[model samples]
Target: MKKAALYLLLITLFSKILGFTREIVLSHMYGASNISDAYIVSTTVPTFIFSFLGVAIATSYIPIYSTIENEKGIQSANIFTNTLVHFVILICTLLIIVAFVFTTPIVKLFASGFDKKTLSLAVLFTKISIFSIYFIGLIYVFNSYLQIKGKFVIPACIGFLFNFVIITSIILSDFFNILMLPIGYVLSYILQFLFLLPFLRKHKYKYKYSFIIDKDTSYYMKRIFYLSLPGIFGASVNEINSIVDRTIASRISVGGISALNYAINLNSFIQGLFVLTITTVMYPIISKMVVESDVDGVKKSLNKAINSITLLVIPITIGSMIFSEPLINFLFGRGAFDSKALSMTSEALFFYSIGMIGFSLRELLSRVFYAFQDTKTPMINAAIAIFMNIVLSIILSRYLEIGGLALATSISAIFCTLLLFINLRNKIGSFEIRNIIISFVKVLCASLLMGMISRFFYYALLNNINDNLCLVLSVCIGAITYLVIIYFMRIKEINIIVNVIKKKLFSSFNVL
Candidate 1:
């Protein structure tokens, strides 16, 4: 498990580096402008649709795939996959066509605050961007299969290829900037989908034209649909939240949608680095364990994941809050992104980062629940959170604008995480709740000290040093302070981290 997590972590880290580069380029080129706003809003239709239906399929398909392969055999599993793939493609393609024809109304629904001109531009972009969902939908199917086979590396690193192509597309957009942007997204999605074909071929997973569904396929398909019903609702919670935020943001100003996107993207980049990496690596194992009725194994896996995420995310969350401005300035304060844009983006980042721990735990916890095939619990939890978020967002946005939207998201996340944890505990009995709380207390102490130290250093070097250098130094100071304090304090979570590092290092040495 540690080894698989390490592979996923390293590859995800690499992809995130390139993804970071991609965001920087996009921010510099477009800033929080109308064009950027329209572009983001344009993609919302496809994003919302794919995130729900597409992600639902991917999230629920893997465990069933494992079950079928175990019970029915690989040939049966392949046929199941082939038929499933064709069905998803056919459905998504039809959806895309409908979305294309009705682009204007969809974009308007997505961003009702857009003016005539911006709405027109968004409609155009939507026409182009919606097609990418076809590839994205296909990618989800392939991703489930790969992860089931314990093929984490390539699936993990494919985002690197996606980012590389996106970077190239952004560079080429100079000649026809606005129109080229969405086209680039489509091209990258295409390439990403194509890149996975070789893996399928290598595994001899043929397409087999699966129109006639056998009994086994029908059984699994029916189960997949049953599982996917709640999965869809659970997954759509965030999409629903984003839609609410974007709609409210659109009322703020022309660039409201763009500012929100930039902030959320930055937050996602950080979360992807560690939180997501752990959860992604754990999902398959957790699912398989649940299938095998390994209750203790599942508990151990969840605890380890929670500890790792909490330990790593504490420093990042606190550090980001302290140095939000410098971080934003360093990453995106140039080109079309001005001082005002940086300030708003940084403010949003601060609010969003405040809930990092909650978000991290929620990521892991939700998967654990999914492993138990109890998606309804999470769906209910998300429905409650979304209600809270909507009420909070409407009331708060009047004052905080983008920051309010983000703050509402944080509050809802923390609420969702708490409820999920309590429910999981009640459902599974107990296993070191007291210890987990103690570790969090220790982490909080360390993070507080790190935040103070980083803030002090940031202000001290404000005008004296290069902006980038100063930002880097401040972050280093915070991270080092947090790690040193945790180490000296002898926190329990620190040891897990130490062991992971030790194992990773020894493995590297053996390979060399």
Candidate 2:
């Protein structure tokens, strides 16, 4: 488990860095203009339409697959898998057809503030990119299957190919026709599906030509379908909020959507690199524990996962708040990313950072509910958050504009995470909430101190040194300072990590 988590972290980190490069390329070529906005909406439309299904499939499939394998055996499970693949492909095809026919209205729903030219481009892009749902659905199923099979490497590496394809396409689009952008976006997913096929076969996963919907398969399909409905709505909370943000942003300014997208990507980087790596590794294990009726084990894993997220996310959040502008400027200040774009993106990043820990916790907690096969709690809680976000966004955007949209997102996440905690205790009894709070307090203190020093260093060196160099050094210094404070504070999670590193070093020395 440790090795799998670490491997995933490394892969995610590397892929995310490449993914950031992809964003940088996009920003350089297009900035936060109508062209970029149109392209972003085109890509976002499919995700907005289908991501709930994707999340629902992944969250619901894991435990269901485990149950079938345990009771009916691997052959039965494989048949169920075949049935699911066929069913998902059929559903995706239908969705694609519908989306294609209503592409303009769908584009309008996501980006209503678009002018005729921008709206037309978005519609065109959506027409081509909508087919990605087919690949996206299959990828989700295969990814869960591989994770269940304990083959994490290939699933983790797909992002590499996906990002590479995207970056290449963006560059080509710049040099040649802009149509290459959406064309490349669709091609990336196709390549990712192809990339996973051989690995699936290697893991003894065969694709049966026959789609069996026998009694057993039918029962499991019904189970997955029921579970997925709530999961879809539960997962859709975030996507729905995103659609709201983009729609509202479109009304705010020309580059509003692009600014939000860039900032959100930066915020997502932290969640993706740490929170996701932890959850992806722990989700399968926790699902098995649930199958074994290991409630205590589930509780223990949830505590550790939450603590890990807090320890990882809090300091980064503080740093992001302090250095939002510098980070955005450092990364995207060049080329077409002008001063106005910089200010909008930085403002968005700062506000988004406020809810970074909340978002991370909500993600982990939601996964726990899903592992226990209780999606309804999260769905209800998400609905509550969605209401809060919408209300706050309307009120705040009136004042804060882009920042208001972002702050509303953070506030909603924090509130939703709090509700999940209360309901989670009611659902599973106390899962060491006291310890989590204690640890969080310590992490927050350490992070605050680190942020102050980092901010000091940043400002002190601003006049004497290059902006990028100063920002990089200040971040490095902040990281070191954070490590020192946590070490002295003897944070339990940090110590565990320290000891693990020590062991690896000692083992390597012995090998030498």
Candidate 3:
């Protein structure tokens, strides 16, 4: 599991870097302006719409496939896959028509702050980008299929192609018409879908073209639909929170939407790099364990995953908070991203960092509940969180502006994560929550100390060396400080990692 996680981590890291570059390119070309804001809202509308169905289906599809494959065999799973593919295409096709017809109103819904000119631009972009959902839906199905087949490489690589295409499209827009932006966005997903086809064949997946919802298909399809309801509600509630944030942001200022988007992309970077890699690797194993009725194994896996998330994400959260400005400035200070944009983005990033651990754990815990095929728990918890977020965002944004919106999200996530942990313990008859809390405290202490030292080091050298160089060195120093502190603290998770590194080093010496 560690080996698989590591492999996917490297691939995910590369892909996330490219994804970040895509954002950087957009910021460089468009910055926190009406153009970037319109493009973001345009792209977000389709993704938000598709996610209501696509995410719920894709997430629910996994354990369902596991169940079928275990009972009926590989061919049965393939049939289900084919049926789902056709179903998604049909649904997404309908969605595209509705969204296209109502593009202006939908864009208006997301960004009520936009004026006539900006609204027109956003509608145009949404019209083009909305079609990408067809490809996006298929990618979700195929990616889930590939992951079930234990082919993580190709799915992980899709980000590479997807982000590369997006980056290219942004650059092309600079030279050509800005309309190339949405056009290229759609093209990326088409290429991603095409890229996944042959690999599906290589994995022995025979794509039979059948849209007939026959008896067996109907039964299982209905089951998927039933199982997906809670998930869809959960996802929809979360999307509502997002729409609320964006809507409020739109009202806040000119580039409020773009600033939130940029900050979110940064937050997503940390989640993708560690939390996602661990969860993606563990989800299948946990699902299989549940299928085999290995309750002990599931408990161990949950404990380990939770511990890993704390050990990794806590320091990142602290470091991000400490150096938010320098980090944002270093990454996005140039091009059209001026001082005001940097200040807005940096403030948002700092506030968002507060909930990093909450966000990471909530995602992992939610998936665990899904493995148990109990999506209702997460759904209820999400409803609570989203309600809190909506209320907090409204009240907080009045004072904190963009920062308040992000802070509200962080607080809500943390609250939701707490609910998940408690309910999971109740359902599973208790894992190692006490131990996890103890370790979390230790990791928090180490990370806090490291942050202080890193902050001091950064300021000490800020006047002596180049600002970016100083920031990079300070991050390196903080990492070293964190490792040293954790090693001395004898944190169990860090010890496991340390032992593995030692053994690898000893093996290399023997090889020499």
Candidate 4:
């Protein structure tokens, strides 16, 4: 588990850095403009379709696949994957065709407040972008298979290909104009999907094309279908919140959607760093444990994950709050991105940052539900959260604009996190509630102190140093201070992190 988590984290870290570069390129090229808003709106539905359905299929398929592979054989598992992959393709392709045929109305629904010309550009972008659904769905299956096969590196690496392609496309768009944006969007998905093929081949995963669903395959489909629907609904509801946020932001101002997108992207970068890495490793392990009825093992993994994730997420959240403006200015304050854009992005980002711990906890807790084949609970909780999000977004966007949209998101997440925890304790036993709370308090206090120090240094260096330099040094001090506090407190989770780094370093030396 440690090895898988580390490998995924390293690969994810690499991709996220490039992803930052991708966002920086976009901010420089477009800033918070109508073009940016249109692009964000255009891609929202397609990405939602995949994230909604594709993640449901991919996540729900894994435990069952593990069972088949273990009980039936590798041959059976391969056939199951092949069948599911093709079926996902068919469903996604049909949906995309439908989406394509209704592109104008979809764009209208996505951002009803757009002017006629902006709406037309958005429709065009949506038409071009919707085709990515097939690729996104197909790749999700392939990527899940890779992870199941203990091939985390390739799956994570392919995201870099997607981001790099987008970055290149953004660069080219400077010369060519807006057409390159949607084209590059589609092409990135295609290239990333293609890149997965070589790894599929290397793994000797045979593609036995069987359109007919035999009784056994029928059983697999029924099981996966029953299992995936709630997940799909839950995921779709969550994505709808994004669509809702974007649509509301569209009504707020020209750059509201763009600002929201920037905030989301920043949060995603933070999430991909550790929240995603740990859960990527945790879900499969816990699912297997659930299948075997290893109650103690499931409990152990959940406890450790919550603790370790907190050890990192809390500090990062505090650091993000302290450095929000500087980070935004450093990454995006250039070219088309002006002072107003920077301020909007930073303010929205601060609210997003406040939800950092909530986001991580939500993911880890939800995965436990999925592992136990209880997707309905999370789905139901997500529904409740989304309802609040919609109500709060409408009320708050009236007053606070983009920041209110973001704050509503954060508030919903916190509610979801708390509700999931309460439900999870009733479902399974107490996940050491007292201990978890104690650790969180310690971490929170330490983070607050570190943030103070970081803020002081940031202001102290603001006039004496370059913007980026001040930001970098302040962040370094904040991180080092966090480390020192954790060490002095003798947090056991620190040992887990240190041990992983040592092993990685030694492994590199041995390879050398």
Candidate 5:
């Protein structure tokens, strides 16, 4: 488990760095302009479709696949995989048809206030992106298989291909003056799917066409669908909140969607770094424990996962919130994105950062229920949270513009996290509630101190040199200060992390 976690973390870290570079390139090439907004809007529909289907498959696939592995061994798992692949292919085909038919309506729904040109561009982009939906869906199944087989590195490395494709496309677009954005997106998914082919071949995962679903396969599918129903609602809630933000932001100003997208990209970067790494590594472990009825193990793993994620996420969130302006200016204050764009994006980033811890917690906690094969409860909580988000976005957009959309998301996440925890406690019988609370308080206090130090140094550096160099230096100083404070606080979780790092280093050296 430690090895898997470390491998996934390393790959996620590398991928996230590349992903961040992709964002920087996009910002440099397009800035927060109508073109960028159009591209964002166009990508949004495909992403939404992908997430809905991807979430369904990912949430259902692992547990069922794991169950098959336990019951009938590798052969059964392969059979299940073949069935699922065929099913997914059919579903994806239908989805593509739907996307093609409703592209204009969907584009208008998401980007309602866009000008004719931007709307047309967005519709075109959406249509292009729809081509990748099936490919991405197939990739999800392959990834789930790899993950269950404990080959974390390959699955995590897939994102690097995505970033490379996007960055290359963005660069080419500069010279070609073409809408290479969707082409980049389609290529990335294709490559993402292609990357797994060798592994699938090595594993001997054949794609046999069999409409015959065995009893066991049927049973598992029923279970998965039943478990996944609530997740559909839950996932829909989350996606709808995002769509609402875009809709509201579309109404606000020309660059509103782009500004929110920039901020969200940064948020996702941080999340990919900390939250995603841990959750991805933890979920299968949690699933196995639940399958084995190892309640104690499940509790232990959950506690460790939560603590591990929170300790890292809290500080990063605080730092981002503190130095959002400098970070935004440094990465995106050039080319078409000017000081005004930076200011707006930074504000959205700051507000989004406030929900970072909640978002991270939500990922960890939601997976706990998933491990227990209970997706409905989280779905219900997600529904309430989504409702809150829509209401808050509508009310706040009138007053706060794009920033309010971000704030609404943060507020909704907070509500969702709280509800998930409460429900999880009831389901699990008990949790490390007191310990989590105490650890969170300690981390929060330390983060507040770090935030103050970061703010002081950031402003002081601004006075000295207000260029990108100073911005970079400010981030370095802030990060160092935050880590130093966290270390001195003797956070117990830090010790666990250090021990793991030492073990991995020594183990690698021995291998060498």
Candidate 6:
């Protein structure tokens, strides 16, 4: 289990690095312009669709498929796969049509502050990007299948390829002087779908049209819908919160949307690398344990996940907070992204970084409930968080501009995390509360030390060279310092990561 998590984490980390590089390219090419804002708003539509449908499929189907795989074996699981693929394809197609037809209204709904030209651009981007929905849905199903089959490497690398395609498209747009942004996203999804075809073929899992839902299939589907309903609600909360931020930011200035988007992108990159990787690796394992009624095993896995997440994320969050300005300037200082944009984005990133641990915890703990097939608790909590976010965002945006939006999100995430943890303890009877507390203390202390080291190095580098090189140097020094401190602390979990790399290296050498 540790090995699997480590492998997935390394691949996820690589993908995130590529994703960040993609962001850097986007910053240079588009900066914090109205076009970038339109691109951001346009991308949100498919993403919102994905969060609503794709998340439901992933959360509901993984445990259901795992259960079938465990009890009835491979053939039964394949049936489930075929049924789900057909269902998702139909649903995604319908959604694409709805999105296309309502593109203008939907864009206006999300970006209410946009004027006529910006609204038209957002609508155009959304219309173009909606074509990727079915392909995106197909990729999700295939990726989940690969994950359940223990083929983590390919699934992890697939997202990196998607980012690569987007980066290429952005470059092409610059050369042609045409808005090829949405085209890049569409092509990426197509490529992602195509890339998984061979794997599906190897597994002999061909997509078939099956409108005939049997009693048993319908039963499972209904169960899935019940389980996934909360996720949909939760996703709605997120979308609403995003719309609130974008709307408020849109009122601020032309680049307001872009600033918020850049900061949020950075936040997503971190969460995807650490939080998503941990949750993905753990969810199936947790589900299997739940199926077997291994309560102790569940507790043990939960503890390890919590410890592992805190050990990695605390330092990164603190370091990012301490060196936020340089990091932002280093990565996005060039092109139309000016010093003012960097400052605004850096401020948002600092506050957002404070919520990293909260978001990471939320991801892992929410899955714990999902593994137990209890999604309603998370849904209820998400509703509360969403309400808090909207109320606070409206009240705060009046004073703090875009930074207020980011701050509101951070506050809401922390609130959600606390609520989830408390409710999880009640549901599970008891957790490793003592260990969690102690481990968090250790990680926090270590993070503080690392933050100081990062700050010192950041200032020193800034004094020497206020350019991209200094930004790069500061990140390196901060990372090295954090690792060294953690090493001296003898965090045993770190060895798990090291061993996985060693195994991969040996496997590669043997192939050579």
RMSD of each: 2.2, 1.1, 1.2, 2.2, 2.3, 3.0
TM-score of each: 0.95, 0.98, 0.98, 0.95, 0.95, 0.93
Candidate-wise lDDT, in order: 0.83, 0.91, 0.90, 0.86, 0.82, 0.82
**Where does candidate 5 have its weakest 10-residue lDDT segment?**
203-212
lDDT of 1 by residue, 1-512 (tens): 77888788888888988998887888888888878888788667787878877877887887787777778788888888987887798889888989988989888888889888888889998899999888889899998888887788878878988899888877778656668888888888898888988888874654444467566578788888888888887867778888989988888876778777877888888789888888888899988887888899888877777777778888888888877887888888889898778878888899989887877788788888877777788888989989999999998888888899999999999999999999999888786778788888888888999999988998899789898998889888888888899998887767767888899899999999
lDDT by residue for model 6 (259-290), tens: 88888889888888877887888888888899
Q: Number of clashing pairs, model 2?
A: 0
Q: Which wins on lDDT, candidate 1 or candidate 4?
A: 4
Query: Over the stretch 148-245, how does candidate 2's per-residue lDDT look in tens digits?
Result: 88878789899999999999999999889999999999999999999988777763665443655656688889999899998888988889888889
Candidate 6 — which pairs collide? none
Q: What tens digits encode model 5's per-residue C-alpha lDDT throughout 393-512?
A: 888877887888999999999889998888888888787788878888888887788778767776777767756777667667767776787777777888777787899899999999
Clashes of each: 0, 0, 0, 0, 0, 0
TM-score head-to-head 4 vs 5, winner: 4
Q: Write down the lDDT that model 4 would get.
A: 0.86
In candidate 6, stretches whose alpha carbon ends up further than 4 angstroms from where it belongs are 204-215, 235-237, 488-512
Better of 3 and 4 by lDDT: 3
Candidate 5 regions with alpha-carbon error over 4 angstroms = 204-216, 500-512
Candidate 3 residue spans exceeding 4 A from truth: 203-214, 236-238
- Which scores higher on lDDT, 1 or 2? 2
Native-vs-model 6 lDDT?
0.82
Clashing pairs in 4: none
Sorted on TM-score, best first, the list reads 2, 3, 4, 1, 5, 6
